[model samples]
Target chain A: MNMVVCVKQVIDPEAPPASFKINQSDNTVVPPSGIPPVLSPFDENAIEAALQIKDAQGGKITAVSLGINLLRDVVKKPLSMGADDLILLEDEAFVNGDSLSTAYALAMAIKKIGEYDIIFCGRQAADWDAGQVGSGIAEILGLPCVTLAKKIDITNGKARIERVTADGYEVIEVSLPALITVSNEFGEPRYPTIKGIMAAKRKQPIVWKAADIESESSKLGATGRRTKLLKLFQPVREGECEIIEGESPEEAAVNLALKLREAKVI
Target chain B: MADYKGVMVYGESTDGKLAAITTELLGCGRKLADDLGQELYAVILGSDINGLAQEAIAFGADKVFTVDDPLLKDYQSDSYTPVMEKVVKEVMPEIILLGQTSLGRDLAPRLAFRLDTAVSMDCIDLSIDPESKLMLQTRSVYGGNAQATFTSESSPQIATVRAKTMSSMERDDSRKGEIITIEAGLDPSAIRTKVLEKVIEEVEGIKIEDAEVVVAGGRGIGSEEGFKQLGELAKILNGAVGASRPPCDNGWISDSSQVGLTGKIVSPNVYIAVAVSGASQHMSGCSGSKNIIAINRDPDANIFKASHYGVVGDWKKILPAFTSKVKELLDK
Candidate 1:
């Protein structure tokens, strides 16, 4: 079995509030100081999902990423974690692409990669939280797609998965050649070992440009994007917080409950 | 130019009852439809759900489209997508709104992809641009650090809004609307995915999302034993127990009890965050809570900034005292 996993580099979602800066002109986030870019946390889970399948099924896993600059550290992180190969869809035109255009470029890359049994993607990117690219890719490739799978196992040309639902979870089974978006409930991703890191240094990722992927320039970037970002701003918080004061923890707790009761919230 | 007419909202139902988010979507859809001078239509797919269709109309839908089939009872992307695609083709609504629940998150993107459109997920607010007549969808990004407004250039603007963010319209049984029964034409053989079984994690007490007050614990809770104190406090207050990501990830609590960007976004009237450091991810989920009371030993904890009330102390000491105080108050 062969598999492909889509990974993206995003500003760490857990970064401190003060670290982020907004560029009003473009309505995009500026990379924070002292905080380096990391692979989207869920994408790391995607790599782990693929690695687990390869470990059990005896197959090669290819990690695909689309972005500009394509940091060396971020690009190799998947390979270091046990992906067999890496494909970088790098071009100036790919920078401002929205979910649909990004999916279009990735579907093209997968078609070029040719042989594959399944594809894996993070449930959603921590940055934009769009959660659309995986299904979009599946639609473009004309394959069935499942989102938010907490556990997945492939057997007899079919993949059985436990997908997350609102109240609980449901067991599902889909045939091979499908796309699955993994959720964090799948479990913690394994950290790369020293030997794996050394091996990653020797395996260089194949770089592809817009022309190499044969995508139209007009349909590959900001021009091709179906959605337009109007503005990026923080919502102004309303109401002043009144602190309940007391000399001791017990007294404070008493005063707090009284305040909630006074407010009719209790 | 495309002549897209009505505003369509996908009405989601569970156990023969309409989901709260469906009414919330209709509330927003009613406003957008009124602004666009288009009718508001609610599309429900399920078996024996005519009652839900009437409820949709009572909650501000001008028209309801019902597709009742046994295959539609369970929500599978492969089974529902074709039927939805067929409905959209026939109805041709200009704006499509859905709740960002599990089903919506799974279905909206697939439908958008099939229709060759784009989707804005987990939006907090929706409005219509008077000039362009396009739907402006606003959603929090980067774990609630900022909100971005998105507008799609495609024919049908698709969006999924977070639950509890928008108000649901009051149900008025006196209100009358049209109900159109549509043929699903679903082929059971075409369904690729099969449902093996559903495992519902049973949680006692009011669900964390629907609770009026939520008592949430974080890494500062120390151990599973600490959660017991939280449960005690919640029980005294007639509320529910929630947790930050660490406790849930560490197996100290169930994943369903998690309150954060990745877990459940809640907006209880009062939220008591115990031993929680208030990471932005966790804060985003509960920021909508009316009153937040943070109890942590560290005075500089970020949670304090987002809290309405702060009690700087050890949770081990604070929780027991808090529970006793609440119990005493309730006893009176």
Candidate 2:
């Protein structure tokens, strides 16, 4: 089996909520200083989905990422987690692209890779939280697609997936050469081992620019955006939490309960 | 602008009635259509959903579109995407709305790409720009840390509205509207996937989304045993127990009890977050609560930023005392 998983490097979602900052001049996040970027959390689940398939069927997993100034350490974490190869569509032309343009670039790169049984992507990126690129790529590739999958099992050249639903879950079956978006409910992704890290350090990622993927210049980045972002701003929070007080911790708990009742909030 | 005229909403049904989210969309669509001096159209698809068209009309839709087919009984993306594509092209609506739901999340993007258009997903606010006569879609990004307003240049601009963010109009049976039936015309061969089974693991209590009061735990809750205390508090308060991602992911609580961006978005009258640090993603789910009460050991925990009331102490010590005190007061 040959599998392709799309991963993205993003600001650490686990960073302190207070540290999240955005630049108003441009609609972009101001990356927190001490925290280095990590693989988007759900994308790690996607890679784990591919890794599970590879482990069961003895196949190869190729991790694909699209961005500008791609961080080798961040993108390479997929390889360190047992993916066979890493492909980066790293170029200036790919910067600030929305779902439409980003998916188009990824579809082109996947076509260049030529052969694959399955394609995996996170349900959504942490930064933009659009949750559209996976579907867009499947549409552009004309491939059968499933989104928000919690579990996937391959049998008789078909993939049986447990798709997450509002109420519960639905088991769906689709043929091979399909695209699946992995959800966080799939379980934690495996951490990189010392041996896997050593192997990944020895392997250099294959980087592809716009020309390498043969993408349309006009359709590459911000120019290719279909939706114009009129404004990006943080919503102010009214921090007026009246901390319940007492001499002791237990007394504070009693005061809290009393306060809720007094305020008619309970 | 001449080619596209009305505003369209893709509606869904639950247990044979119009879904709450669909009604909300119709309500929202009604305002936008009235603003544009156009009509509000609603579309429903299912095996035996003809009855819902009239319900949609009563809930603020001026016209209703119905597509009845066994193939569409389950929302397979392949079938629904094309079906919607055909309907949107034929209807020629200037703006289209869908619920930010399992069906909409799976369908809107694919449908938009197929129609060579653009979509704004999970929008909290949507309106028409008076100057340009274009739809302004505002959505929470960065997991509710920031909001972005977007406008699509393409005709039939699409957006999926978040659940409960928009209100449903009061039903008026006196309202009159037209009902149009459309042909599914789906090819079984074209459907590449099958839904083999559906498993509904409902929590045995008031659902967090519907609860008046919610007691939520987080990583600080530590273990399954810890969640049991939260359950006790929820039971005493006549509410439901919820969890942030860590507790759910850690298997201390069921995944259904998770309240976050990827989980359920809930806005109860009172949200008591126990030991939750209020990450932006988790905050996106419960920030709409009328009052937020947070109890955490760390004084600087982010939960306090958005909380209305707070207690700085260990949940293990505070929760039991708080629960007892509430029980005592309610007993009187």
Candidate 3:
């Protein structure tokens, strides 16, 4: 078996909300002070999904990422977690693309790699939350796609996937050479072992530029975006909370319930 | 240029009736269509869906298109995307709206890509720009820390709206509309995916998404025993129980009970958050509640910022008293 996982680097979403800032001029996030960028949380789940398959069935996993100035430690985290190879499509030309451009680059990269039975991606990136790139890649590559998968099991030549839905889950089966976008319900990703980290540090990433994929310059990065961002801002929080007071904690609880009743909020 | 004219909604239904999001899309679509001085159209695809066309019209659509086929009975990217692609190409509507649901999340992007267009996912609000006549799409980004609005120049501008953010118009059975039928034209061999079974992890009471009241706890809730207390409070209030990511991650509750950015988005009438140190990620799910009441030991917990009423106290001491008092008042 062969597998490919797509991952991305993003500002730490767990940072205190107060630390979040946007550069109004560019509508881009200003990395919070003292907090380092981490791999987008869901992408780790995607890698875990691939790793789980590799654990059950002997297979090689290749992790692919596209971005400019990706930190070595952040991008290599997948390799540290047991991925066999790391491929980076790093170039200034790849910056600020929407789902179309981003997925196009990845699809092209996968086409160039040429030997894969399955591809996995995070349900959505923590930064944009668009949740479109996986499906875009599947459509561009003309592969069967499943989104919001919690588990994947391979049998014969097909993959049985537990797909999460609004109410619960559905068991869906698709043939090999499919794309799956993993959701967080898959479970916590494993921490890299010390020995694994050492191995990762020794591994060199294969870098691909715009020309390497043979993609048209007009359809590669920001130039390929089909949508335009109009504005980005935080909506102001308006109301001040009225605190219910009492000497005893139990008394405050009683008073809080009384307050809810009086305000007709209960 | 292709003549892209009206606003269209890709409506959904289950158990023989329209989904709530479908009506809401029609309600919103009605306005956009009227603003453009065009008709509002709805397209529903499924087996035995001829009866739903009338319901779509009652909701606000001026025309309903039905593609009745067993292949579409279960939504698969292979079957539904191509059918939608064909319908969209033929109709050439200026705008398309879909619910941000399992089907929408899977279908919208593929349909958009197949049509050589783009789509905005999980939009909370959408409107047409007066100047550009473009659909202005606004959605939460960065774990709900901020919002970004986007627009596109592509024909049939597409967006998937988050559930419950838009209002549904009153159903008027007297409303009149036209219904058109389209052949499914599906080849069974093309669909590579097969749905084996649907398992519903039925929660014992009112669903959190539909509950008027939601009683949610976070990491501060110590164990499954703590969730039992929340369940009691939810029972008393005729509501549902929810938890932040930690409790669900810790196995204190099921993942379905998790409420946050990655969890379920719930917009209820009253939200009582207990022992929750509200992270922005968690707040994204419940921030739409009409009134928020918080109880936490730390007055500085981020939950207080979003609460309409708050109490600084230990939930272990506070929750029991609070639940009993509310029960007493309600029983009277």
Candidate 4:
């Protein structure tokens, strides 16, 4: 079996909110100082999903990413975690591409890579939270897709998955050569060991440019983007909090309930 | 300029009844359609779901499209995608809206990709640009640290709105609308994915997402027993219990009760967050609540920043007092 996992490098979502700054002029987020970029939490889950598959069925995993000025250190996290190889699609034009174009570029790269039985992606990117690219890639490749899979297992040449739903969960089975978007429910990702990190340093990723992937120049980046960012801003929260005054915890609780009743919220 | 016209909404149903999120989509869709001076249309796909078409009209849709098929009764993307693609080609609606539920999240991207368009997922707000006639979609990003507005350059602007952000419109049975039954030509054999089983967990009380008031706990609650106290307070207020991701991940609570970006997004009348340090990820789920009251031992807990009222204390003692006080008020 062969698997392809897609990963992304993003600003640390767990960083203190005050540290994040936005560039209102370009409608983009500015990475905070001191905090280095890290692999998206969901993408780590995707890699873990791939590793689990490899552990059971014995397969080679290739982790892929598309970005400009590609953070080599950050993109290599998957390789450190256990991916056999890494493929980076880096170009100046790849900057700020929308979900459609990004998926297009990825599909093209996958086609160039040739043989693969399954593809894995994070349920959604932490930055935009679009959650479209995985299915978008499946569409471009003309393959079946299952989103938000919490568990996956290969059985009788078919992939059985447990998908998360609003109320509970559902079990679905699909043929191979399919794509799945792994959700957080999959489980915590494994931490890279010292030996794995040492081995990763020797495994340099193969980098490809826009022209190398045989993608049409017209459909590469901003030119192929179907959505335009209109504006970006922080939502304003008004009104000062009225801290309930009390000498003790019990007193505060009583005062708080009284205030809620007066406000007609209960 | 593209000659695109009406606004279309995907009316979703669960267990033979129209989902509340579908009604919410219609409410927002009605405003967008009216602002664009076009028709408000709804597309329903399920076996024996003709009744939903009428409900769609009462909620605000001017025309409802029905594709009743047994294959579509269960949402297989392969079966529904071709049918929706055919409807989009025939209707040529300028804007397509859906609720950002599990179904919509699975289908919208596939449809958008097939149509060569773009989609904005989990939008909290939508408005039409009078000058360009483009749908401006506002969605949370960076774990709810910021909101970004986007417009599709393509013909059909596709978007999925988060539930509870928009209220469902008042239903008017007197209103009438057109119900068109279209042939989906669905071939069940073509679908590669097969559903093995669906287990709907039996919940004991009101769902946390639908509750008018939510009493939530976090890691500070200490243990599963701590959540029991929170549940008692919720019961007294006629509300529901919720939790942050930590408690859920720790197995103190079920994932269904977890309120965060990865969990359920809820907007209740009042959200009482106890023992929860307000992470942006957790706040994003319930920030839309009308009022927030936080109780934490640490006075500088991040949750205080987003709260309308704050109490510095331990939840163990405070919750009991709060529950009694709430019980007293209700007795009056």
Q: Which candidate is the best by DockQ?
A: 2
Best by lDDT: 2
What DockQ values do the models have?
0.72, 0.88, 0.85, 0.75
Across residues B1-332, which tens digit of lDDT does each residue of candidate 2 receive? 67999999999998899999999999899999999999999998889886899999899998998899999989999999889888988999999999999889999999999998899999999998999989999999988889999999887899999998998999999999999999998999999999999999889788788899999999999999999999999999999999999998899988889898888899999999999999999999999999999999999999999999999998888888999999999999
Task: Name the weakest run of 10 consecutive residues (lDDT summed) in model 3 chain B.
Answer: B1-10
* TM-score, chain B, each candidate: 0.97, 0.99, 0.97, 0.95
Q: Provide the lowest-lDDT 10-residue window in model 4 chain B.
A: B199-208
In model 3, where do residues sit more than 4 Å from their true spots?
A: none
Please, what are the lDDT tens digits per residue for candidate 3 over residues B17-62?
A: 9999999999999998988889999999988886799999999999
Q: Taking the tens digit of each residue's C-alpha lDDT, what string does model 4 give over A1-266?
A: 89999999899988888887899888889989999888888999999999998988799999999887667889999988989999999887766788989998999999999889999999998888889999999999999999999899998888999999988889999998999999988888999988889889999999998888878877878888889898899888667778897888899999999998998878
- Candidate 2 off by > 4 Å: none
Q: What is the C-alpha interface RMSD of model 3?
A: 1.0
User: If both were scored by DockQ, which would come out higher, candidate 1 or candidate 4?
Assistant: 4
Ranking by DockQ: 2, 3, 4, 1
Best-performing candidate as measured by TM-score? 2
For all predicted structures, in order, the TM-scores are 0.97, 0.99, 0.98, 0.96
Pull out the clashing pairs in model 1. none
Tell me how far the alpha carbon of residue B300 in candidate 3 is from the true structure, in angstroms, after superposition.
2.1
Name the candidate, 1 or 3, with the larger lDDT value: 3
